[model samples]
Target: MRVLVAPDKFAGTLTAVEAAEAIAAGWRRHAPDDELDLAPMSDGGPGFVDVLHATLGGELLVTTVEGPHGEEVPATVLHVGDVAYVESAQAIGRHLVTEGGAEFATTVGAGELLLAALGTGATTVIVGLGGSGTNDGGAGLLDALGAVADAGQLDGGPVLFAGLSSVDLAPARAKVAGVRLVAATDVDNPLTGLFGATKTYGPQKGIAEDRLYEVDGWLEQLAEATDRRTSLVKGAGAAGGLGHALLCLGAVREPGIALVAEAVGLASRARAADLVVTGEGAFDFSSRSGKVPYGVAEIAAEALRPCIAMAGQVLVGSREMRALGVENAYSLVDLVGEQRAFEDPVGSLQALGERVARQWSRE
Candidate 1:
């Protein structure tokens, strides 16, 4: 049997490439004679650039940029023929911010990386938006791109936006006037409301529950200072409102997984495989929202192949899993417990892969 192993990054534990390798290794252990194909995936999150680079063979331009906490960090941009690709998480990933620092995290580095991509003379720039720690409604990003605001206001967090006086986005808009900016995102939430960036993602980034509305209001003020209409656009809330900023610059939104799937030729691979396996850090109902697992399973289903998922945790019931197009789902935590799953994610994931292969592998 031919098995296609594809997975997104295991959050903090592994990159998509590493996850694919680990799962493939385990599958080989159980079914050495079975052919295996590895196609790691990303939904415009942390491994976005790397996955694209691996499959597209693009030029990787490395540069130093501001991190979530105003620190310097390394990031990479993938430049292909006439387009450039960047991952927002490389600059503002949730893991880069410490507890209680989410309120102050900035997307400045992401803007800087965008500038670098622009410097490459690419006409089309695709920004992968997800796993962000900042909640400043992309003020830092606008500031980095020459959108002038009150001195020091756009440099800090949303808390500082309360006193924001004025914003001039002309220069930023002019910079990308003729360029095509695409916001590749996994989410479709608007910028500032109940289902928006702050209320939905701020808690995970360390914002207190009571502060959700307050922080969201700050983002609203940011939208008011710029383009209020763009704030309500789908995906405006992705990457801590980085999506909103890009949209403000006239960017169109695209489902990141769809973009990734096309770049990786996932459909053709699935068509050639007898079985497909895909996963991520967590598998739940939310997976249906353009995540890698759901996207991969969809492709597998289109190919009329059986699809299964192996993840760090499986929160969806079997019926829900089937609804996502996954024939079955396996959890590392369920197989080896939570403590071991985190302490030794690669090993635990490999073990889970082996167990799943035993049941699914046609030996």
Candidate 2:
């Protein structure tokens, strides 16, 4: 049997690459003769470029950029000649931002990276817009790309909703002339309101519940300052409104998982495979929103292949998994307690793989 192993990052624990390798190792132990095809995935988040680099030929360039809170962090950009792939997490990711850093997490670092990519002569720039730790709606990014604004307005420096005087995109346009900017994202949250950035993702970034409204209002101000619509556009709230900024600059939005899958030729491979196994950190309702596992499972469904899902914890019920075209879903935590699952994710995931093989290898 041919088994295709694909998974997303386990969030704060293991990357998709690490998890895929571990799963393959365990599957080999259980079914040594079975053919294994490992493909790791990302949803425009932390490991976007790395996952794409796993299959797509590219030169991964490393550089230092300003962190969300002013510290310098090492970031990577994938250059496939005239096209550059930049993942926002490398600059202002959740892992690099502390609780306090979230309060003032700026996209300046990400902006610098984008500016540098512009300088590399890349005609097409693809930015993975997820796993952010900012609430400033890409003000810092605009500033870094030559937009004229108050320094405080660009630095997550407590510029209130009413304080932002203006935003000029002319300079930004002049800098990125003839370049196509694509904002890669999973979610389609609008820029403001209940389904928007602050209400949906602010708490995760350390914003006090009471202050969510205020932070959201600031983003509204940002939209007004730039003469852009606050709501209605999908993905405008992604990466703390970085999506809005990219859209403001004429960047087109694309579903991240599908884009990566196309880059990796996942559909053809899945069609040729007998079985598909995809997983993530948590398999919940959110997975339906164009996440890696859901996308992979859809490919399997289209190919008439049985797809199984594995996760650290399966929050969604079996019915939901079935609806997503997943034949079976398993959780590492259910097999080996939470402590063991977190303490040794690789081992637990490996065990899950072995268990999955046992349940399906002979079928």
Candidate 3:
């Protein structure tokens, strides 16, 4: 039987490619005759550069860029002809920030990465904006790009910065006069509101409640200064308002997973596969709302193929997934203890794969 193994990163443990390898290893151990296809996946967040580079045959360009805390960090981007694929999280990601200093962190490195990619003569830059550590609303990014923010008259302006508080963007905007920026995001939230960047994701990024309002106010001010008046802009709140920043800089926002999936020919793969397996770190009610697995499952379902999901944890039962066209669901945590399972992630993945294979073989 033919089986396609496609999974997202295990979050702080295994990358999507590594997870696929582990599952393949286990499946091979249990069913040597089975044909296994591995397609590592992402939702346009971290691991985006690697996956796109591997799939699209791009040159990986590595450079030293500023980190969130004003330190130099090794960051990479993918160059495919005139198009450059950039993952914003790599330069200023949540994983790079420490607890105490994350509050004042910025996306300076992200801007540097963009500049580096643009310096390669790549006309179009595709930035995967998520998993960021900063709440600076891309002020540092604009600064690195030579845009000066005007903090005084933000409330009403034709060229508004999305989140600059005391910062300015006039100088930064002057540097890149003709570059097009495209932001890929999974979220659809405004830069300021109840569902704004700070209120929705600040706590996870280590920002306190008292400071949430402060950040929101800053975002409003920046929006006004940049002359960007579209608060209803979809994905404006993504990647700690990186989306908003991109919007202010004339960037177009698109659903990240769909764009990447299309570029990777995900639908074709699903159509040709006898069975498809896709998953992420967790599967819950949220998984049904345009996540990676949900997107893959939709394609698989349309092709009349059965799609199964194997996650680190399954918060929603099989019944919920059935409505979403998932044939079955499996959780690594359910089969093995969470702590023990992650200790040897490969081993645990292989064991889980073997069990799943055995069950499929019986049918």
Candidate 4:
């Protein structure tokens, strides 16, 4: 029997590669003769570049760009001939925005990286759009690209500019004239409203909960200035309204997991597998939103394969799991308790992997 092991990053603990290795190792303990295929996955977040790089050999390019805090930082971009993949997290992701200072962070560094990718003469550019550290509605990115005129307003503070009533997007559009820009994200929130970018994600970035309205308003002002109506567009709120900005610039939005799956040929692997195992840090209702686990489960379902999902925390019960195409589910917390699960993720994951293999091995 052949088994496919595909998993996403386990949040603050292991990366997708690490998780896949652990799962494969554990499964082998019970099903020694089972053919195991490891396919680490990502959904346009922190491990996006690493997963694609690991799966598909590409030219990993590096360049210095302005960070979220205005310092020079090295960023990575993957060049696969005429196509380039850029992970925005390299510039302004959660790693760079731990403290509350991210309330005042900018995405100019991400813009600089995009410019560099464009300079590589890539006809198509796929940019990961999650795990950002800004809430300026892409104001800083536009500024770096010469669209927004007030660099001070963009680079200095949290969203405070009500004066961005009329931004000139000609320069940015001209720069992207021949290139295809795709914002790869899993978020479905729009740019403005109760469920929008600032309201839904601002607090996580350290923006005061009460101040979310102000930040959302700031993004709204940017939409108006750019002559865009992205408030109702799904995924326009991703990356602190960066999705809206990209849409305004004639770029398209695609689900991150789908793009990565296509890039990694996950479909063919799933079809060839007798059993599929996928996982993430947290398995909840939100996993339905184009996350790695969901994508992997869907692929398994398509190929008439049974999928088992494992996660650090599994909030959904069996019925919901089945509804999501998961034949079985396991949570680390249940296996070794939450504290230990958080402390020694690797050991706990391996133990859990062995348990699954013992109970459900297709050998």
Candidates in order have lDDT scores of 0.90, 0.86, 0.78, 0.85
Query: TM-score, each model?
Result: 0.96, 0.96, 0.91, 0.95
**Candidate 2 Cα errors over 4 Å, as ranges:** 150-152, 157-162
| 1-363 per-residue lDDT for model 3 (tens digits) | 778787878887888888888888888888898888788877778998887876788788889998887678998989998899889999988988888454568787888998888887888889998788777667667767776544432212112344445445555655555777789888888877799887898889887777777667767776665545654587888887778777767788888778778888878887888889887888887876557788788888887889998888888866798976788888889898899677877788788888988888533
TM-score of 2: 0.96
Report the lDDT tens digits of candidate 4 across residue range 1-363. Answer: 899999999999999999999998888888899999999999998899999999998899989998888788889889988999998888888778757765678888888888988988899999898988777777777777878554236554445565756778888888889899999999989888899888898888887877777777777777777756765688888998778777777789999999999999999999999899999999988899888899999989898899998899999988889888898889999999999998999989999999999888866
Clashing pairs in 1: none
Model 2 worst lDDT run, 10 consecutive residues: 151-160
Residue-by-residue lDDT tens digits, candidate 1, 1-363 = 999998999988999999999998888789899999999999999999999988899899999999988889999999999999999899998878989888888888989999999999999999999988888888888989999886448877787787675689899998888899999999999999989999888898999998888888888889888889999999999988999999989999999999999988999999999999999999999999999999999999899999999899899998899899999889898899999999998888888888888998888
Write down the worst ten-residue block by lDDT for model 3: 152-161
Give me the displacement of residue 108 in model 1, in angstroms. 1.2
Which residues of candidate 1, in runs, are more than 4 Å off?
Answer: 150-152
Error of 4 at 206 (Å): 1.7
lDDT of 3: 0.78
Ranking 3 against 4 by TM-score, winner: 4
Alpha carbon lDDT of residue 274, candidate 1?
95
